[model samples]
Target: MPHLSLSDLTFTWPDGDPAFEGLDAVFGPGRTGLVGRNGAGKSTLLRLIAGDLTPDRGSVTVHGRLAYLRQDLTLDPNRTVDGVLGIDNQRKALHRIESGEGTEQDFADATGHWDVEERAVATLDRLGLAHVAPTPDALGRTVGTLSGGETMLLGLTAALLGDPEVLLLDEPTNNLDLSAKARLYAAVDQFPGIVVVVSHDRALLDRMDTIAELRRGELRMFGGNFAHYRETVEAEQEAGRAAVRDARADVRRQGRELVEAQTKIDRRLRYGKRMVAENRYPKIVGNERKSQAQASAGKLRGNHADKLDEARRTLTEAEELVRDDREIRIDLPDSVVHPGQQVVEVADLTLACGPTVSLAVTGPERIALVGRNGIGKTTLLRALTDMPPRVPWRALPQRLDVFDETRTLAQNLADAAPHATAEQIRGRLARFLFRGNDSDVLTSALSGGERLRAALAMILLAEPAPRLLMLDEPTNNLDLPSLQHLTEALAQFRGALIVASHDLPFLREIGATRWLELTDDGVREVDPR
Candidate 1:
């Protein structure tokens, strides 16, 4: 069986930041989903397993052949299907052996190459790549004519042709069409070897036999799929939060007892002094009693201090187990529409891709534009912006390249608006939840979620205060927190919104009033529920 083991594995980047520290783990014969937030070293771990990056210390032991499929692949338009599957030389040697012109070396090479053609054909047929490989002569056809998704699947086929013991896939489903994604998922399901895939796609993760989470330089194994792992983590977080609350209460109680003890000691000391003055007892006896009281007070205070310290330590440990899941709160007062206000109007305008959507917005309306890749969603959004709508509009693309990273949030907003006063810009940023010192934060210093909010702020906080906003795949590269932040902001937007996205959960959360499904014949209304 194919397997992998890492013994005290450690890795650090060239920039001096540690990616993994003393990581020790073993992967056996099963499909494992490697999950974590962006920059949590999930991809880095995959690279380490694939031998792309050498470990800083320790060793990786492999029991069988390994194949790795990376995200950014280089394509050669002139390559044939046999070449793409990396079986050209072997297939050629087999051909030479069958033609009676085979040399001794060719005959030797053809020994293992006998079944290479059959195996390549079967793999291509399974992945829906046979259609692009030229039906009669699939292996002889050039792959330059293949689609993007076809190209990716062809690469996966090449990986599987070797029948390796371990296969590592990094974001294999990214940018794939629905049909391609389904085909890839099917391939993963039927694979018999150990498969480790790094992906943020929930649907893909849910197909795994086991989940391994890489968080904060620690590796954790969970049985079952992504849903099961999430349930376990949520339960752990609940218990951790309860522990934190209990520890805090204990600290408070200890503090109160310490103060009360001091007060009682002071009262007793004063009483002893009064008794000595009144000659109720000998002055020496009173003095001795006072000294004893002071000693007891000091010991009591020390004991309470120790208890407080222990409680604090307990609180810190509990906090480490609990993850922060705060969502953003948006309040854009400027986007409000009074009576008789005009919004964007889409007349029976048919798009170049043949999608005709006609709607008039007079209030805060939210529209969800969804379809498969290359369905003219972005083109439609760009068309809407050119309609010369009654209100100002801005569209946020997937890259979010609007903000100047070198400038602060406030400065960026000011640069966009230009006419807005400093106070105005800051107040607008506050609506996007960037209040107080957050205004001075550089765009480069913000998290993924904060950067998104900053982008939205700059758009909606324009000179005329845009009432029409368009967004394209806002949740593409966002982690969980960033996704939540985007949902929160969009849900509360007081303006019109037309968002094109494939995230069903996000669309449901925003409560989109109109769901437009772009189809072959323009767009059809669908219930996103």
Candidate 2:
């Protein structure tokens, strides 16, 4: 078993905003899920632990070797599969030694790794990349030829080949198909080392032994999986709300008591003034009594004010314990379709390298498009958008590159809906959690989740609206909160929907009415349950 400890870690971006400051955590053996909202520094923390990025202050200590699989993996097109696997040199050395053309250095390079090729093949096979493993020149194949999902799996395979005691995976499931996700899940479950993963995939988090959440520059660890963390946080929030309620009541009660006490003191002062004015007692006696009354009134007022201040402090402390769980709220009644209206009519359409099929969607049918990677799910979605039916339609591509990166979110929405005014665009974007100046942010600067939200705003807020909406892997890079907002927003949409995704739980959350699986033969309807 190995341990990874972060002591007083601090890091800041070049722009001067601190991603993390004085953060500390200890991760021992077993799988740990690192979850947080977008831009919460989950990826930054992982990079720090991997030593890919240096911290501005403090240190990251690892008891054993460490390996990291980054979220965005860029490989040279000319690089071979073996090169990407990092075993090419060892394999070459072994081959040279075997062919009697090797030097002493070749033996040293290949020492203890004589079966490196075999191990590499086995690792790739375990990760569902066996198709590339068996080819005679598979190891020499160009990386550009592999699919995006296959490339991600290859990265994981390389990491596993290193056999590091501390493994860090950043959004490993992104772009992966369902089968690949399953394979990755199995690998994580069986891994004996300390595995720390930063992902938004709920399915993957459910398999973790611990859940570590980073929020607002602090790290909090919760025992068990995501489910357990959810349960614990929900319970804590409920109790916090109750405490706030009690504290608020106490403040109100103290306010009323202070007012009553002040009223009594005012009455006493008025009586003392009347006694002095009427000469009800001797001048000296009346003056002495007035001074005593004033002193008493001042003491009473000070006591009440102090009590009120103390009550307010207690209320503030109570409020601090409650979490801010705000969710997006949006309504699209204009995009709604009648029960008898035809949404989509695909007649004898042939997708690129996909099945030829005919389908019709009436009313607000929600379709879940599922399939393996490279089976042309994206192609099918594009084809549907190309030959749109009588109704207005829009397609959200997997890449989410529908917007102009140079422009702001508001400008993009305005461009999409030429008839809409700037105020209208901003108002609509606000519902998508882009309030005020947030809509002014450049699309290029937006995070993955922010970009998705901005894209959704542009599509949904366009002129005439889209009654037939298609989303291709919309959940790919979304954080948990963003995913929830997406699900909620989709649930409120009354238009026809075709959502292509590998996240089964998300599909179910949005209430998919129809399940369609794309295959080599064609698109066929199936039961998602």
Candidate 3:
């Protein structure tokens, strides 16, 4: 079997923050999906496994050739398809030999290089890039015009061309459209060697043979796909929560017993003192009785204290097993709009991707704007929000431009909603779960979930509080928990919403009243369910 294993693997960042510590894991010959929270170090673990970063202490043992497809490798605008596929050098050498004017070394260099173009073309074709021909000109096609999904697929093709037996992919589906994701999943399903992918895409994870979760510096493996992994975790969490409740009750019981014991001891001591004062027995005999009572009291108190301490320790352990995923409780009281009120109306508006759209919104209508990647979905949203509207509106672009990284989250929200007093902003931040010192954390240091909450605050709490809110692919950058937070927040919005997203599950969760698909011709109503 083509085996990959890690023994006592450990890693830390330059700033002394540990990403992984004493991590040991093994992979059999199949696709394994890795999942975790935003800062749980899934990418770091992949890097460590791929040998891109050396472990602080331990070993990575691989039984076959390895290749890694990085999640965020930015392609140069000038780079060609052949370059992205990593066969530019080979193609160039082969071209030189094929040309009428060529040196003898060029022919020798082209020995193994001749088949590079063929393999590249076939791989790309297999990945649904049949548009990329096998010709030299097609190989020279630039990557600047390719969509984000196509670029990602191109990277995967390059990795495949290496004929690696062990492949590692980190967030391979980020920013990819539904079609691209489907193609990627198919490719993963067809891989002949062991593959490990770290991604938040549920559909992609479902195709995996196993799921591995890294959390709180520990890596755990589950024997099945993402759905199975989630089921197991959910059951375990339920049990853990019950354990915590039991432990807490035990602690309280022990506390009550300790207090009762103290009270009894105090009563006994008072009785002993009274007997001594009364001279119920001889002075020496009374003194001995008092000493014995004091000793017994001390022993009883120590016993109860020990029991309470043990109970507290058990409670702590139980609490650690249950994740504390705080939620965003959005309350937009000022944004409420009556059912008869008109929100926005547009007619025959041309989009950047050649589609003309026209739509009207009223009351608390929720609209889901969905389309393929590189289409005019985002552009249409920008155009709609930029036009003069009869009502107050706000837009949250996919890049989250609403935040200023230099300031704290509270400061950023304050800047966004300058008309509001500091107290108002603090209250809004609290509802988003950034309470007290949490709101004071720098925006740059905020996690993906925190940033989402801050972004919500920046737009929704702004001046002339928006009655119509527009968000562009909000779920693209969010983790699973953050996605849920966003859904929860959007659910509470009592205003018109125009959300552009490729996430179907999220759109459904938000209870979008209307589904609008931006086609090449124009926008049309479609039932995504």
- Alpha-carbon lDDT, every model: 0.77, 0.85, 0.82
Ranking by lDDT: 2, 3, 1
Question: lDDT tens string, model 1, 409-509?
Answer: 99999988999899988877776667788798778756444566788778766767677788886765455665676687778877887888777778889
> What does candidate 3's lDDT look like per residue over 1-529, in tens digits?
6889999998887657687888888999899998887657877788788878898899999999898988655789788888887777777777776776667777776776678877888888877776755555698987665655666788899998988999999878765778877888888898888999988888888988999888889989999999999999999999999999999999999999999999999999999889888888888998898899899999999999999999999999999999886656666546887898988889999876588889888889999998776667767877877886668888887656677789988888878777888888888888877788767888876654456668877887888888888888677546787677678878888888899887888899998999999888898999987
Error of 1 at 111 (Å): 6.5
The lDDT leader among the candidates is: 2
Arrange candidates by TM-score, highest first: which order?
A: 2, 3, 1
Full-model lDDT, candidate 1: 0.77
Q: Which stretches of candidate 3 lie over 4 Å from their true place?
A: 1-3, 51-63, 76-78, 104-109, 132-136, 325-333, 337-347, 350-352, 385-392, 399-464
Q: Indicate the TM-score of model 2.
A: 0.90
lDDT of 2 at 445: 73
Best by TM-score: 2
C-alpha RMSD of each candidate structure in angstroms:
5.6, 2.9, 3.7
Q: Choose 2 or 3, whichever is better by lDDT.
A: 2
In terms of lDDT, model 3 sits at: 0.82
Tell me the lDDT of candidate 2. Answer: 0.85
What TM-score does candidate 1 reach? 0.75
- Runs of candidate 1 exceeding 4 Å displacement: 72-125, 128-131, 134-154, 177-179, 325-367, 372-472, 494-500, 513-529
